[model samples]
Target chain A: MYDARIMPKPAPKKHLSAKEGESAGGRVTVSIHDVASAARVSIATVSRVINNPHLVSARTAARVQEVIRKTGYAPNPFAQGLITRSSRVLGIALPDIHGEFYSELLRGADAEARSLGYHLLVSSEPRREDRGPANGSLAFGLIDGIAVMITDAASNLLKEAKGSLLPTVVLDTDLHAKGVDSLVVDNAGGTREGVNHLLASVPASSLYFVGGPEENFDAQQRASAFRAAVAASGWKPRADQVSFGDYTSEWGERWAEEHLKATGKGVFGVLAGNDEIAIGVMQAASQAGVRIPDQLRLVGFDDTRLATLIRPRLSTVRVPMAEVGAASIRLLVRRIEDREAEITCVHLPTSLVVRESSVPRA
Target chain B: MYDARIMPKPAPKKHLSAKEGESAGGRVTVSIHDVASAARVSIATVSRVINNPHLVSARTAARVQEVIRKTGYAPNPFAQGLITRSSRVLGIALPDIHGEFYSELLRGADAEARSLGYHLLVSSEPRREDRGPANGSLAFGLIDGIAVMITDAASNLLKEAKGSLLPTVVLDTDLHAKGVDSLVVDNAGGTREGVNHLLASVPASSLYFVGGPEENFDAQQRASAFRAAVAASGWKPRADQVSFGDYTSEWGERWAEEHLKATGKGVFGVLAGNDEIAIGVMQAASQAGVRIPDQLRLVGFDDTRLATLIRPRLSTVRVPMAEVGAASIRLLVRRIEDREAEITCVHLPTSLVVRESSVPRA
Candidate 1:
């Protein structure tokens, strides 16, 4: 079974005469002409053999194959890169490997990469805590592409990278780098939908929106939607409705406690940045003798694994992780395959997942 | 900010320096000396700079470095098969990219390579359906070294590979190939401890193990521990106590349902191979009206994030994913620095985390 499957292998790249603009990096760094010279074969013969070979005599093909294999010839990667300069690998550097969002993104990227037979090289924050741009040193390698999660893809690192690396696809982050792709979710739209769903069904008089990282794109986008949702509902609550933090569960719990302790508190609904913050909100609410949904129509963003696992099952706006992963890979690989392929940007869809966390607030 | 962290950087070659021994292929194809001369550097300079660089001056180092860089030089990768050759990129092939385990490992390996100014070349499964060894076609000119997962190391693609082709390290899958430094999690001990934990916590009357891939070493070891745990507790539910799968949550849920259907029975506790399987089991149990801990106890291996994310938080044996990741990088890099240092097999400790999942069966 395995042998049969191995027979029809992916054909090696043909060093065709089809011309490509020399990447400002000189052409012929390691050319097919060199392999042809050492093997003493016509360039056409080599190209013909590489692309389609039943036409060649067995003897001629074997000799060429020997030389090519012996030289460890740079054909596929080099030829592909020359044509599109897209690195087949999508480079994503994150701050920590322990997060659910990162893991989900990896899964999404994996599914997409596997469909295309590409891979991702993951590098976390450097071991030496002193290292600046922990993954900047890693960026020098050949990659057809890259995908950066905005939270992990801090602006500092993006602002200071070597010129002419892989074409990047940014996920949920602002990008200033020219010639790169950016894909952000409809953070505002999704959050607004979630809030409207809760307010339409719930009888809560006042609502609050928990926020995430101060300068975070998703956090800011979600907060804007929350403000709009509250305004549309014609409910006038205090300015203290927004509580910001790093989107940690700790922040969720702490904010809940602080709200409960504050004078004349009316916090009823919380629209959190992501699921982690939602978890903290739930835990804190539970301990503070506040019931979920009944007492607070809570909603979270990025419906990760934590959503279902939590009690009262967190209602959230599914940020479409798999979509981002698939889109990023496709955009990056296309960039690698066709240089003139205009830099592509995609806004993947998100939806509200109504579960037990937010229901008709009675 | 980026100039600083230049500090870090595996193999399969039983006869790397045996000048008199016949290579498995009976050919000494290329030598480092030839590469040095072609690049215009002295033999000692190439040796110090290439093999061990404790003795080279900075100015000569720059010139020699430029020459080697220009020549696109590398040491022989097919150690015993073809004598003299070089490819600078270190190739890593991964089974999947989505899991916490694999991502953390990639992070570890990337960290090590980046420190030593080495670039990484990565590929997903060349064939999506075929899980066999990688065809030699992907092995061409891209990498100077290789660190493989070794899941299919027993296959010909692995057996036929030249040990000297690159510096190679096998991760977790445990192929003790000659001249290859391997990093494996001590599955036997980790499983034994997990099984022992189950025995201590659950009732003696009922116990079962839901295992991973039958061919997997990690699964087999864990299964064996189940047998030992049962014997110590003087309980043998049945020889059919074991259920097989690919360590996925889907399979775990399926197996749990099937087991519940058959024999019209319920076990006191379920000891599973991984967090994925445990999740499956939990999902199945909840659907079947089986209350966790109160009605049944459960424990799983690999204290993955999913364990905590799930309700009645999984009481699992922590596999120390971060430690495994950090340690593997250090071990591989240290091996590169000094090969004679024992072919180390590291076993980062596993701890049992008792949560609501495995409360003393009420």
Candidate 2:
């Protein structure tokens, strides 16, 4: 249904065209034709100059270029693409765009993409059912390269992308395709530090691990690290000490409710999968009169801005989200430029930031 | 310089071409030739079936289409754009890509744009001096419509957009251009509610307003509303009672330091222009040994995710950021489809979310 509030009233009387010299305010833009006329050159010669400068003679091209510059004529990308085969645009597919993490990534990628003389077309990963089978490489002509940030690489979308042979760089998720490049941060390293810090303040037997989605690559890496850290601490985590979360505050809250009721005073420390869950745990703990760092200590991953904003302040793993994003674009652009370049996986580093939430209260 | 990670290594041996069937993964995609061969039709006839079905006989078209469907051949957008002049792509230009506000807006717009069968190309507003005169309207040919979320509408980019004749929608900032449409939340209403809430918790004379950047449209609207609210309360705010910020947490922190050092204890209530500034104020207040709610009452605008995450859970005016974003896309699409459509200004509603930060202690 049309959103009426945002819809403009119909005006059938006036025909609006996107062609040149028909602005609503009567402001006319100079067109290629205007440049051609002013320069006394044919439109084909003008086109040849812009797309293939070497084709035209230096003297004639110079004169045409001067007129083109003076008239401010921008060639249509579509018309240019027919000859150049380069749209000079890149596409990025993310799961969604609401989160701070995704936005920061987009910013980094966009900055890098623009500096490389490319524009970014970003979209949520479309449902497989929504895209017709024939539309597998529909973006082929419109965009030179694509960077897919889908969490689940085994999905039909990724499978289709794999077969499409598009110059693609899979972010975070490990597809391990023969030719596609992959980029990820050192999830396990940061996660290990988070667990180690928690153990330093509390016995391993008293520390719990709150894991994120099972299908998540980062979650898997983090959970593995937590297990290793726990084993290294010479403690076997009880079944009840390990909980699963979907990387959300609500899940964190829900699990916290169960954990607090079951363990009561037994669990003195927790290493959450992410900051959202840790915050949720804090909220639930506060409501239950369990003071952080006094009754309980917690550490989270992905030290997003939320880590510092919460009461008691969350100590967590800091992922350089923007840099990861920039790095992903750099990888994808290289793939686009060199189709046969050896596949490379660049793993950026992550660090731990200790805050009040994970510290013993004075 | 090209980002080293994203740049391809020297490939003297490999010649890269983006033509059909050649994939980086060496996966051969089905092309129009495959459909033509399978359907027993000439390539021109197959192209006609895909691009201009009306020109082909119904029986022949059905045969070609069935083969096309069976083979799963996706027609390229560039090849199609050459004939149809429609890319089904929309461009969104924002001041920057960072921040929860801009991200939420983008999420809304991106979701809506996709649902309407259009992809979104997002870019930061280029520096005015960086863009060539011709580049100003270059997006006109690349995208069907343009939505700019820049705060300063007087920039050269907006001026060039005003005259481009491309269907455009300006968000937040009111360009008031004859042809462009605008969509914004009730900044004044939301700001007033925040201020009124603060005054209710403390004496009107004890309250202060922290404004955002002067060049920001929302900041101006909020500041004007703050002043009006104060005037209505029968109190004239001294010059020291109103401070300006750059809509950043750091600026909020900086201004709060000045306010506290100057007023000491007289200003117990504050209405911040946005959540970032409010968060800054909270940090500064905490550092200065001022307790929230009891010693200082605060209200922030734009009820971003930061509000709930922060200590005391900031009371804020909930700007329907995602909805505003969705509305902007809907408006721009309408304008593009019907250039004769009358201009529209959609002011979405805002509500005050009262949390612990604005409530006085018992």
Candidate 3:
């Protein structure tokens, strides 16, 4: 299990032979060729015995094992992978790998993958456009399947992943493609609850919707839900009352700063697309001397850790990010194991968590 | 580039042959064997031409590539990796991956790894002991090298990683072994600055240190620095003033709640092990009607995002977590590229970010 000589120094450039048993120092090492000859079997047979022993005959496997033990022949993992055609690795492609939301999702995905005897090969690149055909080949070559979290509806990543013809699971997006499984948070339902919670405290006309990126599917669902909920309450939101921007605190702060300067004195309700945006609004409102739940009431989406840590403890829609991550892996694995399995589009439910930011203390 | 037929369904169970060119439906596909025969070159030469093109003669590589294009034969990545003995993947093993600190560190590491043409294979398991020899082999079989972040000084992860004899870089720990490079934050220097800042406002005896897990190297360093700084102020702190617990807000809250109950009404200073712990202390003190800075001034380490989100904006020590992560990969890559490179330990500096939590606003 603990062989020090498993990986010898890489052979010199001049030595172009495919054999890995030869050390750079001109030392003779036990090769798979030697094992196959000793066992009176082909090299492929020896590899199958090492990587997929169940596939080989018991008598032949025993003979190969005996020869391997006697010869001190350590099988190269790459060779084993080549014969098995299974790397036991899952590729994960996300919009970004930073922040609490992504962290929790990754944590869940990682745990599920590990439990299922698979390791995660996370794409470190953040930009979607940068991951071209080369990256698709890289993913196809390395992993059995891939789990892609598509934040932007317009992203070509989902199409590219589908094009790779590898089993795939799409996360946090509403768009559906053939031969792909999807796991999405109930964004509209959660947004409706958040809007109603805010409407209960403040007038619907004073309500504002701060959305995520325009191309984001979750953001679109949430924004649409906010409009529908407001309409049901018999109030139509003005065009100026709704805004869309990237899901960052900076964007939220900028929008709030401008809104506060324009509407200097009014009690209003805000439904931010996500927690980070809500936190930004809270910061801007605080700086402007607008007391929370007094001059401004806010509800955030994705009950991140920051929701509880903030002063007026933000009210938020709790998206089960970790559960979604785990579910994505399960779905992807199912698809990989049985390519003919029915395509699934799962929607995990979300609930609203009411806190001091939405309702003033009695 | 978007070849739909790249991966056919797996062959039937009874088809024990190592060849991947035959589909389960009995369709004949172009294989590497065909490409090699067509080009009149050895299979190994064809593989080298595809994977390590520089190692093959320009004329031979062109011939093989042309044959591959004409035959529409896509080289199996596993076969390519087997020939070159390079996966172009880096493994990352962290104690935990579900927090802001770890997220930021991963983001940095991921970015750096991508820039270096390597993807990260992050170990999903959280516990150290669960990663036995089997896990070690899995890692050794998959990645070219690894970056391990050791939180607990007592953790055998470092030892096991060393035993694997793979090129490794240890992060955020003081413990060092031969042949393994290390990258650590300047915990002591940052702690000293935090302590002196608090001492200028409050008496040294009234100061308390709420540390992370006793086994954690960073926690140990911060605690020692606190003691040294207090002693430098010509004051001896009671043993009761210092405490060690896990780096969570619950521990900070629990410790502060108990301390408040025991020593009820005077102003004091606290130096928490990390931002999470500091936020916990703040929450408990707030619930108990203790005002930050005015009643209980505090400082924390690892200026995480929570530091600013919490009320009064926590004064904290800023560990360059992202830079530390990037540096670890750089060191590991250096070691992986040059086996005989000098094993060096790098300490990135930390600084104090003073905020409203530590000083009363004028």
Candidate 4:
């Protein structure tokens, strides 16, 4: 079907036609000639919208927008080192190869991509430094754009990948890098709220902030927020109260045991790194013969499935994982169909979904 | 890079390529060309071994067998239909659209598919009848083959799909339909062993089965196995000894509560349909002021992640979910690579993994 709907295209280069065997984030050689003929718009109008959007009348813009969305078109394949066009596949590079969260996220992305007549090619890096060719390999062969979720984007491979003039979305990372749209959970906001909920019910000093992997963006934000919240409350919570560990529940248990013993059963509260750690902590506390929220308050982040399934259900910061997945595909696909489509950084909100875990000062 | 190191020209139409893709029960499709090349003999001599075994020495057949193993070539896809060429996409239709098991399975399949240079196209059917055409869409041009978890199969679409010769793997379904390859768990074996383990110290006749969705093949097999085990022990178990319920934790609680009210608070020795049901049963017993194993012993199936995470760690039948995921993809990609590979049902072994849930039955 020839699409007549249009949207404002601001890129100087508007052609995004398919080339044989293109890769992700490559220069999309597809031009406005393709969109105009496919959408029944004049090439001149396409150019006006791409290079100079204000010049196009509102009616023409709307028509173009519909056409782009309908066709599921994408403009850049240069991120994958391909100049030819292939919009059928999206490239997603995840930081961790193992984990239910990333796997589920990709499932959500795959579902949306299929619904929109597209497919996803996922790549993963075993570690931060192993992020280059291993992850960049995702760009191989006709990818319309890139969706990367890695911690250390400063690595040369990620850095080069970042500067490419391709349509891209960054997940769970900083937006300081130019020419990319980032989608991040409100780490600080969620953590701050969680700590507040715990402190409101319990009055205690020397609250523990369990930090995740040192380089992790989410973990870093959460650690800082907990400390800041405690400071704002004018609590004399010891700086030594902060303990570092991975996000695994095992770490939570180990840390809690050590902290509890050192304190000799003194008044204490804990802000765990994530749900996994939170679960471990709760279990360890239970084993150590501690009552939850009554004698000691505990809070966790990333309200994962474990939060509810565990006993004395966890009160955590709910990460909109599925929504993030859905939004990334929506944003990426929209950009693909419209070379001139606006680049947006959509920040999904997080909330403290209180269950029976943490309670007020007893 | 020249794959021509051992390259041979495509054999003529008589190459027996079509024989590779069918049921293993049928004839093996080793063509004269195949055996002749493998034996390094003339086609005329290779033909003699088949038509006139006396004319060709046994030495030649031995050589041909060696080559077959080395090349790992078999013809099953040719026998199946649409064997030689397939879309790079493989379709997996899951019964339910949610849960960690499906998530992990999808990840495993996706990982394997990626390794084999293919991508997965997943579809979720809310109900059994909703399996075909996905949300009423007319086509599945997105994928070349189908993999179903079988709850949504067993309908007209399956009958039609099989006849159409779509390379299909029907998982967890025991239906010996004409063309589909079945991959199923050893449900009966696991349950029998599990019940035996728990019942060895306690009398078998005293035990009960908390069955899953009565329609599920695994659930049915498990219930059957438990009954048979009780019977084989030379004890006639009463019909009132067992309870049937959906394979959910909520049902577990409900059924346990009902059992307590019916039996007047003293029912022991329970085997759950799955871990979820077992968990629910535990909750119910706890609420009723009955302690686990002390007052009532429980056994669960499908040692999902929840098994180890919960208190009084679940004693369950481990389904090997990750292994199944890996195996399905391995088997599937092999089929994709060679249509006429082999056609035998794969039965991955299942076992009982005991932890803290069930205690000695009295």
Computed on alpha carbons, the lDDT of every model, listed in order, comes to 0.66, 0.78, 0.82, 0.68
- Using lDDT as the measure, the top candidate is 3
What's the distance in Å from true for residue B255, model 3?
2.7
Which window of ten consecutive residues has the lowest lDDT sum in model 4 chain B?
B75-84
Best by DockQ: 3
Clashing pairs in 2: A330-B6, A331-B6
Sorted on lDDT, best first, the list reads: 3, 2, 4, 1
* Preferred candidate (lDDT higher): 1 or 3: 3
lDDT of 3 by residue, A113-219 (tens): 88787889886445655554555424566788998888765666677677666788998864445546888899889988988988887889999999898877888
Stretches of candidate 2 off by over 4 Å are A1-58, A126-140, A261-267, B1-58, B126-138, B257-267, B286-291
Off by over 4 Å in 3: A1-75, A128-138, A175-177, A260-267, B1-75, B128-138, B260-267
What would the per-residue lDDT of candidate 2 be over residues A14-109, giving only the tens digit for each residue?
A: 223323445467534455666665677877888788878999999889999998776667776786776666788888877743388878888888
Interface RMSD of each candidate, angstroms, one decimal: 6.7, 2.5, 2.3, 9.7
DockQ of 3: 0.49
Model 4, A229-299: lDDT tens per residue? 88778875676867777878789889878877776555567888888888888888888888786666788
Order of candidate numbers by TM-score, starting with the best: 2, 3, 1, 4
Flag the better candidate by DockQ, 1 or 2: 2
Which candidate leads the pack in TM-score? 2
Per-model TM values vs. the true structure:
0.72, 0.85, 0.83, 0.71
Please give, for residues A236-352, the per-residue lDDT of candidate 1 as tens digits.
Answer: 645787767977777888888887666243436778888888888888777877877767778998887668756678899998776776777777777667757776567777899
In terms of TM-score, which candidate is stronger, 3 or 4? 3
lDDT of 4 by residue, B1-362 (tens): 68865888665555554335544463433444665666688777754554477887788866755765564443322221132234465766665533667766776776666666665655554344433352322123324566777653344445544533556676776554554567788888888888787676567656878887776666778888888888878877788766676867888888888876665444467889988888888888888887877767788887777788888888888887766666776766666566787675788888888887786435
